[model samples]
Target: MSGQGTGRKARLAGSLLPPPGPARMLAVAALVTSLGFGGYTAGSVLFFTRGAGLSTGQVGVGLSLAGLLAVGGNILFGRLADRWGPREITMVVGGLQVVALLLSTVVDSFAMFLPVVCLLGVSEQAGKVCRNALIGGAVDGDDLVRTLAYLRSVLNGGIAVGAMLASIAVRYDTRSAYQILLFAIAGVSLFGYSLYLFVPRTRPAPRLRKKKDFPKAPPSISYVFTGLLCGIVNLGDTVLTVGLPLWVIGQTAAPKPMAAWLHAVNTLLIVLLQVRASRGAKTITGATRLLRLAGWTMAAACPVFWLAHDFPAVWASIALLIGVLLLTASELWNSAAIWGLSFSLAPAEARGAYLGKFSIGTTLREVFGPVLVIGLITGTGGSGWFLLAGLMAFASACAGPVVRKAQRESGVSDGTLARGRSGSG
Candidate 1:
């Protein structure tokens, strides 16, 4: 690290949140990138249908398939980040994002739109892997979770601002409004990518470390299973983002606007409290505790949502608010826990690769979580919510044994276990 980098790190050490520099750069990039995406998202359906002349079904099917295709980028780039270093790959991906945006902007017909959207999807995934690896590498130990929380908090803020601004387009409901927003979004991607150049560069981490240096390291395979477990527990997220809103409208007496208000509360609470929530997550066992907490809280919240369906209108509103609170709690704690565990779960030899593979677990949730949520909850009845809750709680409970198994198999220290630190559970 240069003197400049050293100074930045020192400042960050004392600060409660991520200090300015690479972390700041990533935050700015997240904000602008999310801002642009939000603008388009506010009117994306109209852009595809009226502006691009595509049918509603075409946009739905096309984007869904595109998301599935996009999921492989993390695995594909995991090794690249390992071999070439995160900064190098991140710059390349940023450029690719520019190209993807250009292709999306140029699409005039549905045929062109399909491939362009798929390209955008892949680019989006690639950028997330590169940028996350870059941030993970740039920030030193323990600070990773808090730093990531800061970035996420900023991104949500941007999305909120952008969503508000996007209503102008929605209100006008014109092709010109859609085009202006779309083009502006492409511009935002270009600007954000350019800023990637200013972030400090780093070389690949050392491939070999002696046990004397740090004992109790696990092999790569153990984390794959761990990632799979983390990903499944992460379904709690999809439940909040997708399943809960639907449940509110379809099953409960709460009005449709209540769903939006719940989301607003969720976002606001994250921005306000994510850093404080990250404090207990420095150790692997601590991370497991947080994940377990997230699972049970989410599970517990479901019954509240179900209760809203049967309660009187006044009670229903109260139940729904309580449910949202629990869901938001799960989201905040799970995020910090995942960030710490993901980075800590893997040792130095291939941290980027491990994180990338770990991320696949979340991607798996994004792609298939809706199906599980809809099939179980929507297809059945309010009971489906309880079933989903039980599953999440079980998954949360697995964090401890999984880490212990990884340690036992790889000949690492079960120090946490020996110390009676196998999480609160």
Candidate 2:
């Protein structure tokens, strides 16, 4: 009987993997989109600082403002996706991004570039919302978690590759090289947009005839609270994206290739470990467990930056890699669990609004996270890591109860509680 039970569990695990079907095809489309976005992001700092001739301070401000615009774009498109549908928004946004990239090649002035970045931010928001919404709509049960994990891994990998290509382009110092990179980005984005052509249109779920289509109850305040916690946790990415690279370049002797190694480590871990992490998290209930794990992991990893001071370059690289592994694992769980919880908890008619609210949380993180990290590093010198660690711990503590409340409110159980209650009864 025990052997039979073990076999059933194994089969269930196997079934959770996304099968080669339309869902898998959509995942592929998502991969292509990631490649384009990743390539652009990897090259953005260099382009702004070198290609467009912006000072470091100006670059920081421009990037922060772009992040703010991204928040708006994410919320706007998320609401649009909920109101209209994912397919239309994906195509429109992806197409716009292609145009934005093409326009970027010609913009010679900072003023011209700023508006373009804002437009690109909108495109980024639309593409991300549509792709994520599609994945939510397409997959079911445990497969949904696995699918999202796989997608994130692919996205990170694409970013790594794009960054590498951008490095090569910048090395050439030829006008043609930059132009080629821009056109390549546009081409990949177009390919990604083309995938939307194949996606079937889904109608909004029917409203209850007995009541109004609007939410009958007051909005769940827990959602907003949860969003704030999420924003705090998301600040970790700002450290990863901007802080780490800058630290490596400024402190280390080998500035040129350091960013590549950092990006590679981040991407490699996600690609290899994300699906495994999702599998482990299958029995974990609610967003709290994941959020707590992320918070603690981030907090622990933050202080490890001090190790860079003592170690040889290779050893430091390894230590940083280990730190990133823990960070990415936290990311793998919190991201999937949060999205799943958000969708599950949202009123059927208000999924879009809820997603918009969620985007706002992320946007707040993006805007403030970078500025805070930059300030802490510049002001206090080496204490930025400790500050980040403390913030993460605080956020994690706040997230736990909210996630628990969400689980109870949604009437979902993670098996253990149900079994325990049945046994007790």
Candidate 3:
């Protein structure tokens, strides 16, 4: 009996382990990087305000400027990664980030802070594009999305641990504590991303053939359209985080602390279930179907959120929890679909360039999504939720046809689509 139990336990443990590949190295790097960055980010506002003596407005403006500059920089870096090599580019960018983080530890004025922050932002975004391109080169087909799912889960776990530790500094609210945390972040970041040296190098993607190919040689109109649509649908993330917090605190009777708990629940759910949710996203059709489901799921959550406003405290909390569950489900479905489609839709020859352009939509979302969410849902007495529901449903409905049309235009056959590899340049 004891021998049989040991065998079953060993099998279960083996089943729980991530498959061995380049993704394993990437996952470890992501975790370490997230741990350091997460700790710093959680306490950064306080650091800037207290340690550096900068006003909130200055910090906000500086960060916004950095974000704007990173938009174009992402494209440039992506092209460079394709021309050079993703592994090399990633290491170079990672080194820059280490430098920037170290500089951030001593930035005492808005002028000094602005440039450092911009460099950090641009480098970070470029690193992401390069890393994704690396994954595209390193892994293939169904395993691509699977690897991303696993990385995300590991990153989240690291961030959670880091944030918990940083909370002590946050609680102290002292300049010394903040500086210590910042220095630690820089040191950790330096050590963490150095693991990239272990990741096997990938070949540079093929160069563009014609100068007059598409107006944008790497990113076609079809890709831009799909990316933008995906970004819009991904607004569900903003709704759950920003919109829900505002709604619960200001509009509903739920306790103020409930927002934090809801966020915790979201992070936990994603870590536990993201890989499972990515199961059907290995092919274009499968990804498109998942996206549609995500839209409907998000739409369903809107009503639940709207309904929460009418309930008593206990009931309101319950409604919010259920609503969050629905939103998280939508997030899982949408993320899986996006990861699969983003890679499979692009030509392998210019994967970095295509993925870089695709990432702009996500950047735009970070820029505009919050403002739209707050403006619509804050003062509209929940009527904005109805409009959002309609938008999600319509977007979901459009995904299938849009993806199919793009596939046809790209001249990729159904078999190619099913394999989730190879697209026309």
Candidate 4:
């Protein structure tokens, strides 16, 4: 690293203890990117169901397939960002998202819609990978955790706002509403991609010259386990994104407007509470602490959906809101911890690959979570809520041990220490 890079790293490290300028910029970009992404998610369900008239099961299939495509995109773009730099890849991916969203406005058939959704999913994954890689390069250890938390909060916050707007659009005109959303998403993507250009490119760390000089380290078993655990916990989100709205529109006599409110409430709470939650998470050094808290919270939150089925009952709305809030809280904790651990655990030379593989957990959730929820809901009828809740709790409980073992076996407690020791060895 150059003298300038060294100074920058020191500054970033210092900011984890306080606050810093680069961290703020990274947060802003994350917020913007999340807003664009959120709007598309909020809008897509209504578009497929109301406008295109797809069945709930069909929608799940489409989303799952799209998610699988995104798995590939996430890995590819994540590595590219690390190799080529986040700035270039972000710009390219952001532009692709804009084009994909715009194209969705013109295409009405499932055949056309399927391909577009797949491309959009890929675009979403690429932008996220690039954004996180950039943030990791710019921030230090503790700040990285806080940064990830804030980024998630902003993303959820944007989704809340976008979902609210989509709700309004659906009330007036579904087609025109989506058209407007596409424009807004394009604008946000452009602004974020532009800001990315201003960030300084980080030089790659130097490679070790000799194999024997390298320390004998245990393979990253925990990393893979963490990925699996994340995939399971993410089922809660998949349920909300696909199952909740479908359930609402199908079971309730209430107007479709209620779906927007449920989504909005979830997004709003995440945006507002994530920072506070992340700050508190700083006190927790062990992955076990974070994962246990997240699992318990999600397990408790999942059964609240049964209340939503009662439509028109005051308790239904309250229960649904409370459940969403709890789930988001779990997300905030798990996300921060995961970000910190992944960045800390990865080999310096292969940080991008590690992050990409970590993201596969999320992508897999996107793929199978929906399908699982749909099947459970269809097969057992009203028992899907219980099933989802159980899955979340199980997943959460498993994540802690998996991460701790990974940490101990790798003989690295944190990424910064790992990087230093690796250099010396």
Q: Which candidate is the best by lDDT?
A: 3
- lDDT string for model 1 (1-425, tens) is 59999998876543423576677777777888888766766677777787778898788777777677766677666657656777778767766766766666556787888887777776777777777777766666546777888887887778888888878877887777777777777788778777766777656533323323322222556666676766776776677678878888888787778878887888888877787787777777777788888778888888888899887777888998998889888878888777767766565445556667777777777777878887877888778987888888778778788766765654434222111111110
Clashing pairs in 4: 344-415
Q: Where's the lowest-lDDT run of ten residues in candidate 4?
A: 416-425
Off by over 4 Å in 4: 1-20, 45-61, 108-111, 167-177, 206-221, 245-259, 280-285, 307-312, 316-318, 414-425
> What RMSD does model 1 have?
7.3
Clashes of each: 1, 0, 0, 1
- In candidate 3, which residue pairs get closer than 3 Å at backbone N, Cα or C atoms, i.e. clash? none
Worst 10 residues of 3 by lDDT: 416-425
- Local lDDT at 112 for model 1: 89
Candidate number that wins on TM-score, 1 or 3: 3
Per-residue CA lDDT of candidate 3, range 345-374, in tens? 777766777888888877777667877888
lDDT of 3: 0.80
lDDT of 4 by residue, 1-425 (tens): 59999999886544332254676666667667767766777677777776666676777677778888887787777666655566677778888888887787776777887888888888888677677776667666556666676667666666666666666667765666767767777788678667766666654444423433332222575786776686676666766777777776775444676676876666666666665665544432554566667778888886776667775856666667787778777776666556656666666555555677778888887777766887776556668778777877788667666776876775665424224211210
Candidate 3 has a TM-score of 0.91
How should the candidates be ordered by TM-score, best one leading?
3, 1, 2, 4
Q: Whose lDDT is higher: candidate 1's or candidate 4's?
A: 1
- lDDT (CA) per prediction: 0.72, 0.68, 0.80, 0.68
- Evaluate model 2: give its TM-score: 0.84
Worst 10 residues of 1 by lDDT: 416-425
Show model 2 residue runs off by greater than 4 Å. 1-17, 206-218, 249-259, 280-286, 310-318, 405-425
